[model samples]
Target chain A: MTGGYGLLVADLIGVAVFAASGASAGVAKRFDLFGVAFVGFAAALGGGIARDLVIGAVPPLAFADWRYAVTAVLASVAVFWLHPKLHRVRRTVLVLDAAGLGLFTATGTLKALDAGVPPVGACLLGMLTAIGGGLTRDLLTGEIPIVLQRDIYAVVALGGAILVTIGHRLGLTGLGPLVTAAVLMTGLRLLALYRRWSAPVAVP
Target chain B: MTGGYGLLVADLIGVAVFAASGASAGVAKRFDLFGVAFVGFAAALGGGIARDLVIGAVPPLAFADWRYAVTAVLASVAVFWLHPKLHRVRRTVLVLDAAGLGLFTATGTLKALDAGVPPVGACLLGMLTAIGGGLTRDLLTGEIPIVLQRDIYAVVALGGAILVTIGHRLGLTGLGPLVTAAVLMTGLRLLALYRRWSAPVAVP
Candidate 1:
C-alpha cells in the first residue's frame, strides 16, 4: 500500500504533467483560455474519474480533493504563460509524460484491487487510468489518439499494470512494489520513445 | 415515473440514432471498422453512463442491458454498409437526432430525481445525459463538439431537463408531462436548425 502522503504527492505530479501536456495542445490549437483550461482539466483528471466511476467510487477522488484540481489549474496557467520555455525542453516533457503514465498505472491498479476488482479487470483499469487522460486531451483537440496511432505506449502501460496486479496478488503490496512497478513502466516508456518503437498495426 | 417498457423502447430508438450519427462521422473520417464501432458505441451509451455514475449507480444500466449494445452495433453496421443511402435521408437523421436529445433529457432528469439529486443538479445531469455521448463522439473524431459550437443545442437540452425536474418536483411526474417536455425540446432544436439560429460567440 502506498503511504497516503507519498501517493498524494505522486498523483499531484502526474496531474501537473498531464495538464501541461494538454495545455500545450490547446495552445497549439489556438483555443481560448477557457478551452485550454477545459482540456487541461480533462487530461489531468479524466482517467482517474473514469476509473472511479467504473468501480462505483462516486464523485471520484479528484472531485472530492481540491488539491488535485488546483494542481491541474496551476499547470494550465503555467503552460499558458511559459509554453515557449517549456517547449524548448523536449527531453523534460518526455520524461514527465513517462513518469505520469507509470504513476497512474500503479495507483489505478491498487485502487481497483482495493475495491475488489478481479486481477485482470484491475490491470485493464490501470492501463485505462494511465492512458485515458492523454486520450481525452488528444480527442478534445480533434486528433486521432496518439496511443492508438503509434508507438509502444499502451503496451508499456499494460505491462506496468500487469506487474502491479501480480505483485499485489502475491502479497507484495508495499511501497517497494509500487515503486518498482512504476520505475519499470517509466523506463520502458522512455526507452520506447527514444527508440521509436511502435505497436503493430492491423493490415487495413 | 416512466413505464418500464415505454422507456426501454425510447432508449433503444435513441441508441440507434446516436449510433448511426457517430458511424456517419466515422465514415466521413475514413476510420477503420473498429474505429466506427467504437465511436458508435460511445455516442450511443456514454451519456447514460455519465449520468448513472454521478448518481452513484454502479454498472450503469446500459452495461447491464445487452440490448442497448446490440442496438448500437446494429446501427453501426447499418451505417457502415448503407451510409450512401442513409446519407441521402438527411432529414431523417436530423429528426432522429432531435428525438434522441428530447428522450434522453426526460429520462435522465427523471432518473436523477428518483436518485434524490437536487433539482438543479438533476437538471444538469439530464442535460449531460443528452449531450455527453455526442460530445464524446465528436471529441473522438477530432472535431469541436457540435453542442459547444453550434445553434442552441445544449440550451434546448437544458430546457427540457429543467422542465422535467420542475415537473417532478411539482408532483407532475406523469407520462403527459414527460411527453410535453420532450416535444418542446425537440421542436426548439428543429426550429433552431431550420431558422439558422446560433448561439452567441465571443468577439475575438
Candidate 2:
C-alpha cells in the first residue's frame, strides 16, 4: 500500500472536491442546511462507503473514520459561504470534480482487485463507487440518476479501471498507467461535455 | 382476520389516505409528477417494507403485492390533477392522514404478532412500520423526521402495539382490543395536534 504524503494529498483533494460538488447539488435542489450537509456527506464519502460494503468491510466508511464527518461539514460551509462565487467557474469545478472521480475510481478498482474480485466485477465496482454518491443524491432529491443517462460516464470509469488492472498485472505500477487512467477519463469527460456527445434519447 | 367488506374498506382507505398525504407532501416540496408518485409509493408501503426487512422477508411488501404500487400511482394522479382543489382543506387532509396512520399501525402490530416477533420487537416493528415512510421521506429531504419531533408520534404506535401484544397473549382477539388500539392512537394524535405538543429542544 502506498502509505505516504502523496496518498494523503490525493485523498484530501478528493474529499474537498466531492464535498463542494455535493453541497452545490443540494443547494440547486433548494434543500435546507441539513439537506446540504447530507448531500455533501454523500458526495465525499458515498463512493468509499460503497466500496467498503462490497468488499465486506463491516459498518461502512463513516464509522471507520471521523474525518469523513469533518470534511462533510467543510463542504456544507463552502455551500453556505462560497456557492455563488464557486458556481461562476463551471470549468474549474468540473475539472476538480473529475479529478476526484478519477481518484476514487482508481482506488476502488485497486481495492476490489486486491480483495480478489474478478476483473469484470472489480471494474464494475470501481465505476459504481465513482458515481454512486451522485446517483444517490439525485434519487433522494427526487431526480433521475444522471449516470444512467447518456454520457461517457460508466464507460470512462471502466476504461480507467481496465487500464489500471492491466498495468498492475504487468507490474507497471509506476506513475505511468495511474496518470493514463486519470487523464483518459477526465479528458473524455471534458470532451464529451464540450462536444455534446450524448446518446440518442429513447422514445418511451 | 376481519375477513369482510368492512375490513377491506378500512385497508383501502388506509392506502388512499396515506397516498394523499404523500402526494400533498410532494406538492409542498414542488416535486414533478413522477416524484410525487414515488413519494406516494413510499408512504403507502415504506413501513411494511421496513418491517419485512427486519424480519428477514426477502424482497418485501411491494414485490409481494402489485396492488400497493397501483394504489400509490392512482392516489398520485388524484393529488396531481386536483392539487389546487385539494390544497384548500388542509384540515381534511390532516384528518385522513391521521386515520391512515392509525389503521396502518393497527395492522402492523397484528402482522408482527403473527410473524412471531416477541412482544418488544413486535411493538418496535409496529412503530417502525407505521412511521417509517414519513421518517425516510423527511430524512431524504433533509428535514427532521416527524416521528422524532411533534405529535403523538412513536408513542401511540408503541402503546397500541403493547395492547395488541398483550391481548394476543391472553387469547382475546375480539374487536375490543383492535378497536381500542385504533381509537386510543387516533384520539391521542388529534389531541396532541390541538394542544400543540412538541419535544423540548435542547439548548446547545
Candidate maximizing DockQ: 1
Q: What is the lDDT of residue A131 in candidate 1?
A: 84
Q: Which candidate number would show the highest TM-score if scored against the true structure?
A: 1
lDDT by residue for model 1 over B65-178, one digit each (tens)?
Answer: 568877997898778778878757989889989999998999899989999999999999999999999998888887888888768889999988888887887899767788
- The residue ranges of model 1 lying beyond 4 angstroms of the native Cα positions read A1-49, A58-131, A137-142, A147-204, B200-204
Q: Give the per-residue lDDT digits (tens) of candidate 2, residues B24-138.
A: 7887898898888888778777887867755555577667767777887898879988989985878887776677767777777777677665666576567767787786666
Off by over 4 Å in 2: A174-176, A200-204, B1-204
- TM (chain A) per model: 0.97, 0.89
Candidate 1's residue-wise lDDT over A50-126, tens digit each? Answer: 98888888678889889988999889988988988985887898898899999999999898888876676677678
Q: Give me the displacement of residue A184 in model 1, in angstroms.
A: 18
| Count of clashing pairs, candidate 1 | 2
Q: TM-score of chain B, per candidate?
A: 0.96, 0.89
Per-candidate DockQ vs. reference: 0.15, 0.04
